[model samples]
Target: MILITGAAGYIGSITSYHFLKNNYKVIGIDNISTGNARALEVLNKFDNFKFYEGNFGNLELLEQIVTNNKIDFVVHFAANTSVFESTQNPLKYHDNNVSNMINLLKICEKYDINNFIFSSSAATYGEPKTNELITEDTPKNPINPYGLTKLIGEYILNDLSNAKKEFNFIALRYFNVAGASLIAPLGQFSKSSLLIKIAAECAANKRDKMYLYGNDYNTPDGTCVRDYIHVDDLAIAHIEALKYLKNQKTSQAFNVGYSKGTSVKEVIDIMKKISGNDFKVEMADRRTGDPSSLVASNKKITSLTDWKYSNDNLELICKSAYEWELKI
Candidate 1:
């Protein structure tokens, strides 16, 4: 069986549904610290899904689930992911993102759960020295606590794999993950500080205005550029990564993105056009640890696995998020 941590969160819930549809028995765990109750309600409809509402830090609870379910693989997605908040509370990020991962690694080692997949982020790349596509080989130089924690997690996995040959892992460093599950009717429901969600909220009149962190970046339109990959495409990448690990039996990391860059102003314009609502946009000073541009070169994952982008259009992403916001 496959175990998915943070199964009630945005990407995890959609991934659980994807696995169920593919006839995989899944054991899901989440503490609901930042997860939504509605996501759990939707996931409860699947017969192949068994959920445990608790943190992975509970070793006894993790032991019970692993022993009872015979979990052989894991997709870990639980962590505090706010870049700005991580700046204010670095210890919290280290404890939750790094220490919690060490705890989970111990459980995996004890239970002989060798196959593992991690939900990493492009934040780990920090400020790109160039405006080129960020390949997996790019040097990792995280600028904030959030990105540093994730980078440390990657280091721990590498160390474990080097010592234990049986342990194999795939760390997917995602760019900007947005949108919602069109098929499952699940959206980004967490109280997120992400740009797309905040923009969608403003478009829906839930917020007064959306603030652009910086409009003076060295890019087109003088705004920061990022590669926004739909949540559904990211879910597919996880499944493909799992399949690749089952056969390769090696530890590797891949960049999960469209290899294209979109500016902050462009995203706002797309959201406005899709929602048909002209919300107020305000310019703000550059936030600390903000990067000028970070786009991914997905050649590694695309060539290595059967993963392909199903929803690469910006309009589709905005529309899916807009529909989900209206429903919630």
Candidate 2:
């Protein structure tokens, strides 16, 4: 069985559903702080799925779960993810993202659960000197507390792997993860400030207008450029990472993206075309840790793992998110 932390959140819930559909028994834990109850309910429908509602950092809870269930692999997703919020409250991010991760790693080591899948982010790259597609070897200079915490997690994993010959991990550094599940009622239910989600809300008439954080960046359209990957495609990347770890006892980090860059204006245009609604978009100053451009060179993941991109189209991504937004 596999243990999934933050299994009620957007990406975590969807990934857990994928694993369950593939006939894998999943044990999920979530504190419901940022996770959606509806997503948890959907996962509860599966017979192979079991859930524990608590903080993943609670050592007593983790100890009970680990002792009771014979978990083989761990997929960690629970952490603070907001860049702007992290800037204001850095200690919370460090406590939740960094310290809690350390606790989880300790439990994993104690139980001898050697295989791990970490939910890292491209924010760890910060603003690169050149606007080139980022590779795994790129310098990690995080500009925000959120990214720093994730980078520190990667460092801990790397150090642990070097020290322990039996332990291995795969850190899938995600790009701009957007869109909802193509399947019904399994999308992002929690409120978010993500661009696509906000655009979808405007299309659904849930929001009067959406704010574009910055439009004077050093990009083609003076807007930030990001690599948008569908949530389902990213979920597949995790499964493929697990398979790779099972086959080879080596630790690696792969970029999970389509190696393409879409500007903020382009994304809004696509969302407008797909949703048939030209929602009002107001410009504002750049957020604290906003990067001008962050496109991924997904060559590493594509070449090394069995993962492939199926929903790489921008229109499909916006449409899927719009449809789900209409429901919630």
Candidate 3:
């Protein structure tokens, strides 16, 4: 069985479904913090699935699951992701992102489970000025607590692997993870993520205005550019990564993205067209630690396994998000 932390979260929930469909038994853990209970309701439909409502940081709860479930591998996806929030409370990021990750590593050690996968972020590399694409080896100079903490978490996982020598891990450094779950029946919810939520708000008329976080970025439109990979593609990557690790493929880290970018205003404009609502838009000062552009070099992931992206350019991404907004 595979143990998935943060299983009620956007990416983790989708990954759970993929594993279930691929005929793997999955045990999921979430504290209901930053997780949608509705997502868990949809996931419970599978017979091969078991859900544990608990935090991975709680060693007692985590130990119980690891002992009772016979967990064969772990795919960790729990962390504070907001750049703004992390800046405000560095302690929250450290306790959850860094401390919880180390605790998970320790649990793996105690449980004798050697294989693991992680949901890392492009935030691991802060504000790229000129690199059109970021590779796994890109120089990391995280400018915020959130980014620095994720980078540190990656190092901890890698260090654990080196120290154990028998344990193997695959850390997927994800760019912006967006889009609804493409498979029928499990659509995106309002709480799925930022981009999707923004489109949903515009679609629902809940938001009369949308704020573009920054407009002074050094890009064509002076807005932040991000890779914005669809959630389904990311789920597929996780399954493939699991299989690759099962086959003992030894790569430790790989960037997961389309290597394409969509600007901030460009996304809002697309949403406006799709939702038929010209919501107010404001260009504000640059958000702290936000990179001008963060596109991943996805070649390593593709070459290593059969993983390939299959959805949503800028306009399409926004359109699908709007559609899901109406549906969910």
- Model 2 alpha-carbon drift over 4 Å, by segment: none
Which lDDT tens digits does candidate 1 get at residues 211-291?
898888889899989999999999999999999999888889999999999999999999999988999999899888878
Task: Tell me the whole-model lDDT of each prediction, alpha carbons only.
Answer: 0.91, 0.93, 0.82
User: What are the per-residue Cα lDDT tens digits for candidate 2 across 209-246?
Assistant: 98888888999999999999999999999999999999
Error of 1 at 248 (Å): 1.2
lDDT of 2: 0.93
Assess every candidate by TM-score: 0.99, 0.99, 0.96
Clashing residue pair totals per candidate (backbone < 3 A): 0, 0, 0
* lDDT (10s digit) by residue, model 3, range 110-147: 98888899888898888775656898888888989988
Error of 2 at 158 (Å): 0.8
What's model 3's lDDT at 93? 94
RMSD of each predicted structure: 0.8, 0.8, 1.6
Ordered from best to worst lDDT, the candidate numbers read 2, 1, 3
Deviation in Å, model 2, residue 245 alpha carbon? 0.3
Better by TM-score, candidate 3 or 1 = 1
